[model samples]
Target: MNAKPTEATLADRHVLYQESVQDVEAEIDFVQETFQALRGRDAELLREDFCGTANTACEWIRRGRAHRAIGVDLDADVLQWGIDNNLARLSAEQRGRIELLQQDVLTVKTDAPDMILAMNFSYYLFLGRDELRSYFRNARLSLKDDGILFLDAFGGYEAPMELEEPRECEGFDYIWDQASFNPINNQMTCHIHFEFEDGSRMDKAFSYHWRLWSLPEIREVLYEAGFRQVDIYWEGTDEETEEGNGIYEPSEVGDADPGWICYIVAEK
Candidate 1:
């Protein structure tokens, strides 16, 4: 008889990644509430750039009957996986309200949306200032006249360090490896790996070669891209535990922790 498969061997990287790296529920909550608070109206259409697996887009569709989402990505396989797994779980009406476009974000054209999301630090892939700015400009053009762009960024003293951090997950261990970094260019190579108790490992399940952009730099580029305003939403600290309290508010200052993640909101 054939031996049983280890969890790592049987696991799907996309599924594991969704479980470990993404919280679409919280993300959508922030996006929706922030947009309504900033714009004084509910946002109807949302565009998700570099939307792997279209998880967030699906979540947006499920939020309301009028809510619609467009997910754009260059990876066809991942898009298909999202259709098969994530989208498949949605009701037919929900699926109809969302679209997954296998197209490049910089050039893809679609109906103007009320907001555009470039989350998961995916835009970090643009290594050059000009390239990154160009992408931002393109994103701006794809939005409504009063549209807003939402992006998540991460950094701190430890961002450029070469290190590996392991965290316990449901049935396996997730490891984030900062495999390499170059301070002079602010470029880095990072990867995610999964390990199972059965002594099996899924190495390099996801890898990224990205620039470590600073908040000032990102704000400058957004302004250069013609955004009327930009704000950094810093996470609040839990008074009791002194950890992030899961509430992010617009702030001009943030703690210089070893590592941290924050959101950038740019209004057109």
Candidate 2:
């Protein structure tokens, strides 16, 4: 006889997403190290655009008393969840240094931050060239004169394929479904699904309708938005393991792998 199916909860989805996708500590470390290398000083203020649960912002504040973070998103419910969960785990002083705003990233105004991050490819939600350029312009304006914008992007031959890939985690199977792709416009629809051990599954727990932007397109927009310089950080492959070593260095060329992710640093 088969075991009974257990329905997963929203909390389960969040936990799985974080465990499977985010490395907040590593991300902050990269931001700090990269900024120091470029500017000869540490970055103090950070703005995480499309912050979702604000995990990155929470980690940013935990770095030091001098560090302050701002998380901007349009989803009030998700922002509240971050406050209740991630923020609640921080010390009062650390929590005091972070702010969450339920506002559009393009229109929200704040003090110029030393670094602005758009990780997880959230900026892909802007499907039009005009909208994306507008966003880059707004982001540039929100930064200090020496500030840098950090954005992550993924692409390769496999990205446009309509297929689902599953990886087994500790308690569940994480599924990345590429539901549909339109080659004409580069519009792609993707979803995140989870299957539990008890045969229960959550389909489309998170869905994204994005226009896959190429690296050249993104770089041109950033330049048009008034960024003084744009640099690409390519991940290094480990010789022993034949996998990404989590070490990224500035590069002008990247390998033609089946799939890859890299960071674009735009200086204002």
Candidate 3:
């Protein structure tokens, strides 16, 4: 049997309420700012697919008077987690501007949005061409004429096996784990495990089964899905920056680095 979904699954209210809100806030801001730069205007409405805790949605509201966001996911528990954890930080005015729905990205629909983002490589869950194409179609139909889709991707020859990386949080240890890999199929099992100072551990705080998609395949699918253009934003090499230097410029080709992470933006 498949491993039970992570506690970070959308319906898990307690975990969402307990997640790192500040880190999430920065990520949402980065997306919004990037979208604004791409569109040459402020993006007022955002649709976040595979939004687990809806923390991004909450941040969108807190950032401005005009912002509004809708978070979509199939799990209900995690959606409630956002409400209990992240939403509580917002004022009543901000709360009204954000909404979370338990729905699948494969079927969810909304008005033409100024921008759409599927962050943390969430779209990788669809391992088949047809399923992924259908998702791209859904995203296209949901975007405004000038809207853009932003997605994150990572790749490396060394990526096809088990790996473990750790980060030290303020009072806890966070682990990003790639426990297994199927090289023949590119299907992998991964998760995040958290260790608190008290020595208690939350194994599999978040886990996912995803197909590792390459840059070329992503470009081809975007074109086939009717996107006007697809461009990449590559990460710059500078070990000095805490998060590493990244620039969101237009590029048709990426570097041949052993491992790389980048974003693909598809214009509608």
160-220 per-residue lDDT for model 2 (tens digits): 9999999998888899999999999999999999987767789888999999999999999
lDDT for every model? 0.95, 0.93, 0.78
Clashing pairs in 2: none
After superposing candidate 1 on the true structure, give the runs of residues whose Cα lies further than 4 Å from its correct spot: none
1 or 3: which has the higher TM-score?
1
Query: Measured by TM-score, how close is model 1 to the native structure?
Result: 0.99
TM-score rank order: 1, 2, 3
Each model's TM-score, in the order given?
0.99, 0.96, 0.86
lDDT of 1 by residue, 31-119 (tens): 99999999999999999999989999998998899999999999999999999999999999888899889999989999999999999
> RMSD for each model, in Å, please?
0.8, 2.0, 5.3
lDDT-better candidate, 1 vs 2: 1
Candidate 3 lDDT, 101-165, residue by residue in tens? 79889889887777788887899999988899999999999998989888888887766669887
What's the CA RMSD of model 2 in angstroms?
Answer: 2.0
Q: In terms of TM-score, which candidate is strongest?
A: 1
Residue 89 of model 2 has an lDDT of: 97
